[model samples]
Target: MSAVTEGRPRSPWAAPPRPAWEGEPSKAGLAGKGLVLGIACLAVLFPLWIVIVTSLSSKKTITEAGGLVLIPKGITFIAYQELLSGGQVTRATIISILVTLVGTLFSMTVSVLCAYGLSRTSSLGHRWFLMTLLATMFFGAGLIPTYLLVQTLGLTDTYLALILPSAVSVFNILVLRGFFMGISPELIDSARIDGAGDWRILWKIVLPLSRAVVAVITLFYAVGYWSAWFNASIYLSDQDMMPLQNVMIQLVQKQEAPMGMGQAIKTGQLSELAVQMAVMVLALLPVAFLSPFVQKHFKKGMLTGAVKG
Candidate 1:
């Protein structure tokens, strides 16, 4: 029906030559992408750089520099030394470590159990149970009521006060539940055929398979426990039971002098800026050190648990 169909020469403009880079992104486009990534990296790294520099700086230098330092004129480990060797600070640090370790272990155990149970639909009233758990995420008993409950339970002035009340986070439970639901049902059935009980299957098969999510939620619990101060301050009346954060708050805000500082630093008062920065560094070190090891899996773990179900 056409000139080309009749085997005649078509118009020259009918077909255009393919561009050499037609399927490939342009050099400028790649460069723009690289620039954006570089800027984002810089944005994240700059704050870390500042914290490191400030932490390493001498108290005198930090004070002279107006509380922030991008580059230190003189570097010293004196702040860290003071925090580690100083009596009260050292004790508080130890308390914090103990609390975080114990609390996280407890939290992960309870959360994993609850999540696995909720993941299974065979239980009677399972829908109602799940809805009740989900409802806690949106609404909670008021602080006063929680305080009253803790008081009535005689958990005041004790470590259990810190660990038990906040044992199971609804969000963490949901995350783990979604992850459990993502596990192939065939694997569970096979385990069941092998005479594995629910607990045994969870311990051997489910937990090992869900390491990424477990680690992520473990980190979440650890961070929360490490940073917890409000409950400790409220529940523990004894000064000995105070966590590192509460101690740091007392030192920084209340200007409470460390025990041996009177004899060590003739100035009588710790350098507020140095003390604050030192406490921050101490508080941050555990998370900072461990986060990198688990950071790679964090997004995958969270999304797998959150979005899949």
Candidate 2:
């Protein structure tokens, strides 16, 4: 090779050569890392694949497989249709949707406002309020006192029992505070000089610029509310008021579908396992569908909040 060719700089996109202290990886080392990553992926995806295959499998297919279907033979929507057709399951699903939507909205609103209020160093009693919030992170009232407080407020067996008690997430607020504080102070001062009120500035500038963090936090709240069943079991007594997660728990625990289960099985001739897998898919789909849209922001948003704080 020519001396000039050998002396050329490496391509910008190419990885830098390892330092002398860090010797080149052997083929075995590379293979081990690849094996570990492959196993991790399989550990997660394998169960999901099984659940989906079984959910779509025919009665004959499940019978032939002797359990969860490993390979799909033919696709079918019967399990999903059956679940959706059941009155109790349908009611529970609607309740879950309502709870997730309302809870996420309420939590986001409260967190954003609280975070913004505290982000301003000049806000009255900001430090005191922050200390109170920090204290909650270190100590909680425990289950009995919280339950008693909710009961005293006549929130038991009401949707408010789920919404009000957990409406304000101090952690989310703190993360948001970190992000908001990282905004250019001069920009905020400029808005103030332009006669913009605190509300106006937040709505017009801060929110627009902080879309990444907002989307991340919204997903966090939505997923939490959607997947929660324990809180429902504790607070809600009426069967009609149960959410989707609670209904799923009932199906798994009772080993019988409480919601038109007979008709569901008759229509599809599906096994009990098929119904359970179908419910699991329903519970998982929303988060799966939503994540891709906001995943690009997840790392950036989380790191900014952590680093700026």
Candidate 3:
């Protein structure tokens, strides 16, 4: 027996103490875990730091550093100013914001409704619906066929084209459904016994209990919409309708006027590299801001349906 239990008396036939595997972790194990976590943090943060610094650096500072501008003697917001002030990048940023906001809301509403409905085993044809959704998870219509369907639906050259096709992710639906099903059946039955209907029960009881999963899914959908460029490129014929990621690619790859000033790639003042870094920073900022919201919910949500409270 361990020292704490050494002085205590126990029944001769009593079960042995909990196994050593369940004991406190060793110093070496803790140290290894700490090292791995630190490395992971460094991996994510280092590149972001570099991008932010380079974007803030003056042309002269960038030149002195000769590359990514690690150490900055001076800082300037010129790159950000140019990117946000006016022009292609500015328009693209606005479009991306609009799409992300609208798309997340639309996706959440549809996903939540579908998941809630499907989670009810007593719902008419729910099993068939569940099987259909599961089938979608495994098979998708080819890209060309999907494009044709969108075109047929007259969604071409519009923001709806970017949204409706992907508005409901089946995987998200399943996750939410699983969480909803984990709610205490006894509690739900009691609510029903008190004359609470399904909708009321859902709004009053289920949603409140499922906040963590909801928040995590919301973050996931928002990030997807925010960072998406492929749909924008394919659906939006006008360059003006392009999202931030697509326009960022255009500016960086073609070295066009993303820094707001319509100057050519090698304008002696604001270099192409600075403009690229600034664009990246702008693209990354939204997801970074939204990430904290997920942490708050997810830290508690992973076990949302695992055990009854």
Estimated TM-score per prediction? 0.84, 0.89, 0.89
Indicate the TM-score of model 1. Answer: 0.84
lDDT of 3 by residue, 45-104 (tens): 898889889989887888788979777677888877777777888888898899889999
Per-residue error for 157 in candidate 2, Å, reads 1.5
Give the number of the best model, judged by lDDT.
2
- Winner on lDDT between 2 and 3 is 2
Which 10-residue span in candidate 2 carries the lowest summed lDDT? 258-267
* Preferred candidate (lDDT higher): 1 or 3: 1
Residue 124 lDDT in candidate 3: 95
Model 1: per-residue Cα lDDT over 88-125, one tens digit each: 78888898899889999989988998899989988677
Local distance difference test, candidate 1: 0.85
RMSD of each: 5.5, 5.0, 3.4
Clashes of 1: 0
In lDDT terms, how accurate is model 2? Answer: 0.89
Task: Please state the error at residue 202 of candidate 2 in Å.
Answer: 0.5
Model 2 has how many clashing residue pairs? 0
Off by over 4 Å in 1: 1-26, 63-66, 262-270
